[model samples]
Target: MRLYAIGDIHGQLDKLLEAHDRIQTEAGHDAVIAHVGDLIDRGPDSRGVVEHLMRGRDAGRNWIVVRGNHDRFLPAFLERPDWIDPGLSSGQHWIDHPGLGAAQTLASYGVDPGLDREALLREVRRAVPPDHARFLATLPLWHLHPLALVVHAGIRPGVGLLDQAEQDLVWIRQGFLDSDADFGPLVVHGHTALDSAAHHGNRLNLDGGAGYGRPLCAAVIEPRGAHLLTGKGRVPLVPEMTG
Candidate 1:
């Protein structure tokens, strides 16, 4: 199967659609498109994103999404939440996970570390509907396929995959990106979208930070390596619609 891995599509629905259309046309046949998460939060149409993915909830549709740290942080606030002001980037995880490193981890795609994080955090949570919330809540921290091991962020250095911690898989980065560690399989990631899918042996990054108005990226990966997919347009990134 020709696999396509997508980077972050924060809410650029139009770009996502364009990317999808391109995938259908370019890939053809039965190409699987997988997302590395952070589907909402920055751009607009967070709801639209959720709806689009939710519609693909049946068999035959080759779509898989893993939850990024951004996706999980808000929900962590909701689940094991500490009373955030419904306004700031103030959270236990945000505070606790201090070693996360380099604000612009996904810099290749114009992920501004300067984005009003507090506001962004608040807005992102408010936009997620119950259905999407449930979906987010249930998302797997990692995706293991025959040819790929997909995770929102990357995995730890020395820890075995089965023995790796969930927090590291979903939130940690420095240890994953800095070390010469090799995951058993080719790990395709989305959290740290550096330049061109930084690959060191067994790990690849595809997150283009679509939420930050860069481009929604996807990759076509097989045992032979991976291919890239990107789309254009803004998707009318407005603020606060419904859920």
Candidate 2:
């Protein structure tokens, strides 16, 4: 069976749909699709993206969505808008940082971002479908396969897979990005953006800056190796360093 791993979607439903179509056309019948998450925030149509995935899953499509740092912030903000913390506080961090698309997401859900926090939260709760919330709540942080370890962000180096901290798995960068240690499996992840996908000998990054107005990417992994599914066709993954 082929394994198609998609990068951080960041609410770009159009790109997500395009990537899905490419994957469906390229992957074998028994393929499984894994999304290295960030499914919401930082783009137009966050609600649409979540709804699309939920529908696909309900239709029996094999999909695995790993949690991301942005994703982690979502539940907290949704559950308790009054709780003020970095990333989840006052919705300002979201506006200033990667959550620039937060307003857009709210708009998609038919919630007015201009409303006061309490009222906005209430509107969100009323507008966002229950299934979408459940889907977000159930996202896994990692998916391990015989040949691949799929994650939203790179994993901490020198730590056993089972012992790695959840935060590092979804939020780490420098340490994990700099490490060259064998990680037991090909670490397929997305968090850091790049002009293109980065394929180190030990791991592969597929971010491709979809949140920053670039195309979302997907890697099709088979027993033999992996290839990037593209509009042109399947492009073989080659080793390269990003920094």
Candidate 3:
């Protein structure tokens, strides 16, 4: 089966939609689409993004969404408004990064962000659809395929897939990014942003900084390797490579 891996969306619903359109056109109806999470925060339409994906899954589309650091914030904040420990919920640190875009998310649900914390919490709890919360709660930390290992962030350099920590799968950087160690399966991931898809010998970084005002990307992977799905069309991950 053909596999299409989408990079970090981070609430850029427009970009997400555009990327999916391209995927559908290029990968055909039977392709499995894997999302590298971070579906919320840092953009204008987190709610829309979640809802769109939910609708697609409900329609029997083959879609998989992995858990992301920003995605965890919603549940944590919903469970406990004070769950803000800079490292935990983005809500606690929203002030430091207004780009968390919580207000836009609230706005999407018709809840006023100006309400008191408790009142806003109540409104948000009441406003957000239960299915959306369930969707976020049920996301897997990683998706493993024979040809590709997909995760939100990168994996721990030397850890076996079964033994890898969830934290590292969704949040790691240095060790995974800097290491050139073979990861068995070709790693397809999106936590670290880049100008475009970057292909290391062992892994491919697909995050094009969608939430940071760049295009959302989808990498089409075959047994041979991967290609970036662009507006013009599919392009090889490594331009110089030839089959």
Candidate 4:
């Protein structure tokens, strides 16, 4: 079967649909698609994007969606847990650090990160149905294979993949990936998008903030192999914010 992996969708429903069509055409038949998460809360059509994914999964579309930091926020919101939505305002989840980076990002963009949690709840509810929430909840933290371990961000160096906490798996960036160390497993991640997939000895970051209009891209990886797929440019990024 053709095993295909795409990077974070970030609610770019049109680009996602385009990417799917392109993948289908390239494969010349149906194939498995493993998504690296961050499916909602940015761009437009967050609801539509997730619903499409649910339909695909329900139809036995051999898919794996590893949980992303953005995806992680919903449960906390749903359960009224301690953590707040860190990835707000900038329109990117993992990048919007609630403690430090979020403030700077909002100031830079002249927007308020303090959009009420209650309002956010209502927006999410309007966009996402119960089935979609269940779908998001059901996603795995990582997809491990002998060849590669796919994660929304990346696993912490020296940490066992299975033992990795959700936050580290979804939100961690440079400190985790830039470790002058190896993670033992070749980690394929999509959280910290770069201009191109950064190829360390074992870490592959396949997100360049495509939802930001840079380019919704992914790296197709196999043992002794890798390639980039730039999906159709339907994902609109506020030009100012990207700068």
TM-scores for all candidates: the values are 0.72, 0.90, 0.91, 0.75
The better candidate by TM-score, 1 or 4, is 4
Error of 1 at 94 (Å): 7.8
Please provide, for model 1 over 1-243, each residue's C-alpha lDDT reduced to its tens digit, 9 standing for 90 to 100. Answer: 666777877666787777778877876735677788876555555557767877875445678888876665445554554533221245434423443322322221234445565654454445445676788778878878888888887788777778888778766767676655546777778776554444455677776655555666656665565656544421221112211
Stretch of 10 with least lDDT, candidate 1 = 234-243
- lDDT value, candidate 4, whole model: 0.64
Q: Which ten residues in a row have the lowest lDDT in candidate 2?
A: 82-91
Model 3, span 124-240: residue lDDT tens: 899988888888978999998877888999899777888988788888887888887778888888888888888886888888998889889888888777889988988888722
Evaluated at residue 225, the lDDT of candidate 4 is 58
Residue by residue across 1-243, what tens digits does model 2's lDDT show?
678889989999999888888877766434688899989887888988998988887888888888887776556667765544443335455533444567777787888878876687788888887777777877888999777999988888888888988878887887888887888889999989987777897899999999989889888888777898888898899877644
Colliding pairs, model 3: none
**Backbone clashes per model, in order?**
8, 0, 0, 1
True-structure RMSD for candidate 4: 7.7
lDDT tens digits by residue: candidate 4, 84-191: 555444554432444323232222223344656565455545544577667777788888766678889877777766677777877887577656565676677788
In model 1, the clashing pairs are 3-220, 4-219, 5-218, 5-219, 6-218, 7-217, 10-211, 127-243
Q: Provide the clash count, candidate 2.
A: 0
lDDT value, residue 58 of candidate 2: 82
Ranking by TM-score: 3, 2, 4, 1
Give the RMSD in angstroms, all C-alphas superposed, for model 3: 3.2
Q: Which is the leading candidate under TM-score? A: 3
